[model samples]
Target chain A: MKPAAFKYIAAESLAQALALKAEYGDEAKWLAGGQSLVPAMNLRVAQPAVLIDLNPIEGMAGLTVKEKPTSEPHALVIKAMTRYRTLERSAEIATHCPLLHETMPHVAHPQIRNRGTLGGNLAHADPASELPAVMMVLNAKFKAQSVRGERWIAARDFFYTLFTTALAADELLTEIAIPLQPDTPTARTRTCFMEIARRRGDYAMMGVAASVTLDANGVCTDAQLGYLNAGDTPILATQAAQSLVGQSISAAQIQAAAAIARDEVQPPGNVHATVAFQRHLATVLTKRTLTTILDFRF
Target chain B: MLCKDFSLRFEMTDVTQKRCFVLFVIKMSQTTCPPKLLQIQNLKSKIPMSDLHTITATVNGKSYTRTIESRMLLSDFIRHELGLTGTHVGCEYGVCGACTILYDNHPTRSCLTLAVQANGHRLETVEGLAVSPTQLHPLQQAFHEAHGLQCGYCTPGILMTMKAFLAENPHPSEAEVREALSGNLCRCTGYQHIVDAVLNVKDEG
Candidate 1:
């Protein structure tokens, strides 16, 4: 199928791109990797009058990891246009954010990852996408810019609903900043991401990302549990996370957290999975992710 | 001529002043301009039209320049424009990877990409996998020896995808081979022969 005829403009600079977006407003769409947008256009589900191509813009495709200084927290900054292939192979990401490195391969297949952009995936805001859950668990922040100015939104607040984000019509997601795990011998942080997809590259019926920080006495100090395909937005198990924060990571604690998460999530029934099945998967994945992070058997 | 001078003045004013001047011109032109010119201006103001784009890309080791509609699919450009039919189009959606090709040395779905987006880029289709007219690439030869094809439709795409995969990972395990081929789906031969063919080629080295 062929797409509807549309005007294309290769954006030369960030300012020009922002101006074009401001001029065209809702009639224009920003072209990132185009893995999702192009296909949607071909299917005639999405037709925009103007496409501002962001591929040619400079300073929008790299990764930078800043280690913690005297009083500052460690941070991992990823430019919006950075490809998934780059993130999958980036040593900087592996060193700074190991959880993302482990979760990268689970994102579609290698071919799709080669062309898919980090910003595109986030902005697409698919309920089943892996990056949103990962970002939610890691407490990442997104920098959105327009001709007016720039502002940062937390990962929890950035994702508003299904296929929608806090981004305005004229705003572009410029960067993703994830705070890295602190280097503390007394309290060690462990993270894990897991999902169950029917096929290798297919979207997961359910996925979970869990991060836990344990103090010296083997008691949990901090915990974050995020689920994909759990609801309209990436669902965060705040009540479940609080339940595990003061207790040691044990089978009973994991089960309690998993049960709370399974009860809190309300996934819609799709052709591939029913609501009950998705809820069951949420429980299973939560347990698996927490166990993997805790390195405890069953 | 009077309208032309008025538009020149409209263009030279500041933004706030220009907005008022443009509204004034439109109101004045509605009464003075001919019906046909007024109709044309009305159509232009209400609707946006697509324009042809000139794109230059190196496909199969040869550079070509073509003017295409902005919405033309790259898979169609490879087949209809450049006359390379090896890259097959299956589902037209990103799900089916039969239209896969090497875009700048990375296996990308040609069906999902716009032809204009491939401008100033390098692409390798199924036609480029052969070393010569009579000679076949090692993977192609292995497919032949191992009976990797029954319908021969998805072979070109699988070959291109695997070529990029093997270049990155010269020695991949059987599990890794299956993982790499997860994107490309082959209905014929049950994929056992295909896996065997790749294993045969890996064993050759």
Candidate 2:
């Protein structure tokens, strides 16, 4: 199928891209990897009068790791246009955010990853997408820029609804900043990402991401559990995460937390899975992820 | 299909213009006409042109420049315009990887990529995989010996995808080959032969 006719503009710089976006307003759509946008356009689900291609904008595709002092937290900064393939293969990402590294292969097929951008995936904000849950678990910050100015939105606040975001029409998602887990020899941090899809590369029926910091005594000091396809947006299981903190990871505690997560999530039924089945999957995935991260079998 | 529809619409517009011209001539000879008639003529003349983009890319080691509609897919450009039909398009959507090609050495789905977006880039289609019209690449030879294809429709894309995958992983295991080929679907053969073919090549080395 052919896409509807639209004016195409290749932006040479970020300033020019922003200016073009401001000029075209809502009628213009930004083209990152075009993995999702082009398909939607072809299906006539999305029709923009103009397309602002961001591939030509220099210095917009890369990953940078910032190691701060012991008092300050380290961060992994990724440009908006950095492709998923880069993140999957980057040793820097593996060292800084191993959870993301482990989760990269589950995003889609390698062909899609070759062209799919990190910002595009986040901006698309599909409820079933893996990156959103990973970002939520990692406490990533998104930087949105407009001709007016720039502002930072937490990953939790950035995703508003299915295929919708807190991003303004003219604002471009410029960068993603993920705070790296604290490196402490005495206290170890472990993260795990897991999902179940009908097919290997298909969208997840339900996904879970968990990050836990355990002290020398094996007591949990910090925990974050995020679920994809749990609701309209990536959901943070706050009650479950809180239950894990101040306690050593145990099979009973994991089961209790997972039960709470299952009760807390309100997911809708789809052709792939029923609402009850999704809730059950959420509990199972939560238990599996927590146990996997703790390196314990239950 | 959209191209056919566009041409049909253009022919219908031509017929309508001819009929309008005849009516306008008749009215001019009979009496003064309303301003609406002249406005219609002006509007007909002002029919906007379709949005077009000029792209320059190196396809199969040769540089070419072409002006195409902004929405023209790279698969169509390679198959219809460039006359390189080796890259088969199974599903126009990204789901089917039959249109896989090497975009700047990375396996990409040509159907999902716009020709305009490929401007100033390098592309290697299925046509470029062989050394010549007669000689086959090592992967193709392996496929031939292993009978990796049945209908042969999905072979081009599979070869392209595997070529890139094998370049990254010279000696991939059976499970790795299956994982690498997860994107491309083949209906004719259950894919055991294809996996065997890739493994055969690895074994040959």
Candidate 2 Cα outliers beyond 4 Å, as residue runs:
A296-298, B1-49
lDDT, candidate 1, B149-203, per-residue tens: 9999888888998899888888889999999988887877778998889888888
Q: Could you give candidate 1's per-residue lDDT for residues A86-127 as a string of tens digits?
A: 999999888778889988998988878999999999988877
Query: Against the hidden true structure, what lDDT does model 1 obtain?
Result: 0.83
In terms of lDDT, the poorest run of 10 residues in model 2 chain A is: A39-48
TM-score of chain B of 1: 0.76
TM for candidate 1 is: 0.90
TM-score of each: 0.90, 0.89
Model 1: docking quality category: incorrect
In Å, residue A94's CA in model 2 sits off its true spot by 0.9
Query: DockQ (C-alpha) of model 2?
Result: 0.19
